[model samples]
Target: MKGFLEDANYSIGLLDEGATLADIIDNCIYEHTHTGKRAFYVGDLGKLVKKNTQWQNVMAPIKPFYPVKCNSTPGVLEILGTLGIGFACSNKSEMVLVQDLGISPENIIYTSPCKQASQIKYAAKTGINIMTCDSDIELKKIARSHPNAKLLLHIATEDITADEEMNMKFGTTLKNCRHLMECAKEFGIQIVGVKFHISSTCKDLQTYIHAISDARCVFDMAEEFGFKMNILDIGGGFTGSELQLEEVNHVIRPLLDVYFPKESGVNVIAEPGCYYVSSAFTLAVNIIAKKTECDKLLPSGVEQARDDEPVFTYYINDGVYGSFASKLSEKLNTTPEVHKKYKEDEPLFTSSLWGPSCDELDQIVENCLLPELSVGDWLIFANMGSGTLGEQSTFNDYQRPLIYYMMSFSDWDEMQDAGIASDTLMKNFFFVPSCIQLGSEDRFSTAA
Candidate 1:
């Protein structure tokens, strides 16, 4: 137990051996039942420490620079910062956040694809020199705003991805690499290395093989222009799976050793956004309204057979306009596990989850199977910290959810062992329950 912590971003609960995520959730739900039910996110900062260790073990030589766009939660940033992880920021605000955390400018890279000129100038003012550029226009933009900027030329990947629409080429083609290099030389911009963009959703491991090979070609081309390139950033495609990590490492490790060997002095790094924080967060949304329809037409206008099966529609406190914002871009197959206890033999009904906005497009989970739910019952969605709650604009002002950060004492000890200053974390937070509101001066409890 310690003094209370009050932060706009979140209040963390340092869990002891007996406390569990389940205990915290139950306590949060119990408090909300007496007060008002609201949607909130529970982040396990311990998971981040484990993920960092996993990255070190599997992708050792290749350093990880976490992309801020994945999830910019304050707690995430704080823990990652303390773990000695570098950052890959996309915009000014992200830079400001990392800067606020006292991260050095050299440890940050501005990787925004379409960077605003103002942001470039801001980076220059702040002494952040590394940024990525793909085209002549972007190169010029960077050259004009940040004359001393160290650049990583972004190149298009040859491998196709699952979403054909997102597959539209972004980075400059390899053939055009010389042209960009020429431009960089003319502008006197320092080309430090090449960057290959790969999304985490792409399961194909061949993408890494091809992308790394292409990057080697880029490195050789840069040499022709007298540019001493050293960094090869295989941009963020990590899915947080240990199996996938090993698979990717197996494919690229040999290639890296052969192409940009240890003697080459080329620093290889990666942008792992979701890999560190995805599984660390859980979102809990309360059922605000419920509707039961028997043999009625669903949203697809498909009429169900008169099999006497019931369909349920549940309206939750948060929706597309809030915590489930990522639903707009990708299909979320997250089926929530009900928090309330139920009979094993209970009949499960066809169900759909909707957000509070009531906008037709605000549907969170299109269809799921669950036992009949009441208005006050809570549903838990796991692995939610991967960018669902990013960009504050989408949230309805009244419905914005708060975050509760938690980590087991053993994990905290491990983080301290991993070189993070334990005293640095002391002032950030003390201890408190997730949903309970305590005065700043109140003595905080480690109870889950």
Candidate 2:
């Protein structure tokens, strides 16, 4: 609590531990008011870097091309950009975002199969010629739009009942993959390689091996078609936490090296969006209110609410509609559990945390088991903004939350000039001119 976070409302430093959560909240609101932005502590993009480094290590022998769509937060993107990872973008907009970040065109692969002619033309014009296609129709489209573009034939991975399963869409069948390659040959597009996605948060490991084997078979098929594949873009599905990248790498690297030898010049690539940002930051909130319920004996002897027990409710300031969208799991709910400060004979109890928004369904945790939390107590939303919020766009009258970085002021200022800011700056700074386009004539100066 010793750093100054700035925004339009005001710049404030961290206070002593004696300070109340209310005070911190008030200061944040104040900073937002003055700076017209809430200054978050972004002294350094620590959380993201740590996670990305872990991912880089774990995906060793297999290069990572962070999916820009996962969390295009400037902080996350800048950190990944500095790390020199390639990008896996699905649309022209993301391609534009990568360009604006000064990411080289060669480091980007346009992986969306059903893109517009303009997107394909833009990708080729910008020298970002590596693209993906799943059908002969798409191959023809790329051929017609960008004859010299290099393309990866996407092979759909079968869905596994694991946590990470990206099979909702994309990729072509073996026959279609071959057809696409042959069609590419007819159109003069470079058939560079093949790729697959194992869906994010997948639980099984061997599925990846199987998917790779399937890809290798497709490579053989492509080779039969006179196409020499140089890459195997295994879409990322490493499901371990950020801290376990090294462990994951140790387990998967040998498998990959043995299966897809580098002597063959067939490099490996991964599209990891969740791995680089998840677990980097926590969403800490205070319990603003609590409620209890009483049960009455129904019809016969069955007690509904029991004796004096009550259903406690802890309301915080964030919710599923905002940054906690991923927790919804296709439904709006959170599994909030409570832990006690000290070991007690009472054991652990449970409760629910609700968001501050007025929506009736704005609950964070449904019924979490905890050590009886009280009003004014704080709880941490582990892996909220870094992982979930990044994918959320405004929808259904819900807005994303303001980021709150916890860091020092001098560092915040330095980053601000460098086009980076703390969460507080995101909360406050609205006047700083952002570079909207890279390589655009308007942003560059004319030289003699």
Q: Global lDDT of each model?
A: 0.82, 0.61
Candidate 1 vs. truth: CA RMSD? 4.4
TM-score of model 2 (CA atoms):
0.71
Q: For candidate 2, write residues 1-448 as lDDT tens digits.
A: 2222112133223223343333334444444334333112222244455555466455666778988766666655655676667898988878887787788988999988689999899988898988888888788888888888888888877665644343356777876776676677777778888888876445556667777788878878777778777988978765436544555565557767776787888998888776666554444455656665433323556566434555666666556666666655543222432322456576455577776665677776676666666765556444443345444534454434454433233334544565544453345322211222333442211111
Point to the candidate with the largest lDDT.
Answer: 1
Worst 10 residues of 2 by lDDT: 2-11
* Residue lDDT tens for model 1, 1-448: 2111124345467766766788777766665676678777778888999998899999997888999988887788888898888999999989998999899998999998899999999999999999998999999999999999999999998666557566456798999899998998899999999999777667778888889889999999888999998899998878899998999899999999999999999999999988998899888889989887853446566766677688899999988877777788877746699999999999998899998876898998878889998998999999888877467544456466657778878787787676684565655555543334333232233333
- Estimated TM-score for each candidate: 0.91, 0.71
Candidate 2 ranges with C-alpha deviation above 4 Å: 1-44, 55-58, 162-167, 240-255, 286-306, 313-316, 330-350, 354-363, 370-378, 391-399, 406-448
Determine which window of 10 residues in candidate 1 has minimal summed lDDT: 1-10
Best by TM-score: 1
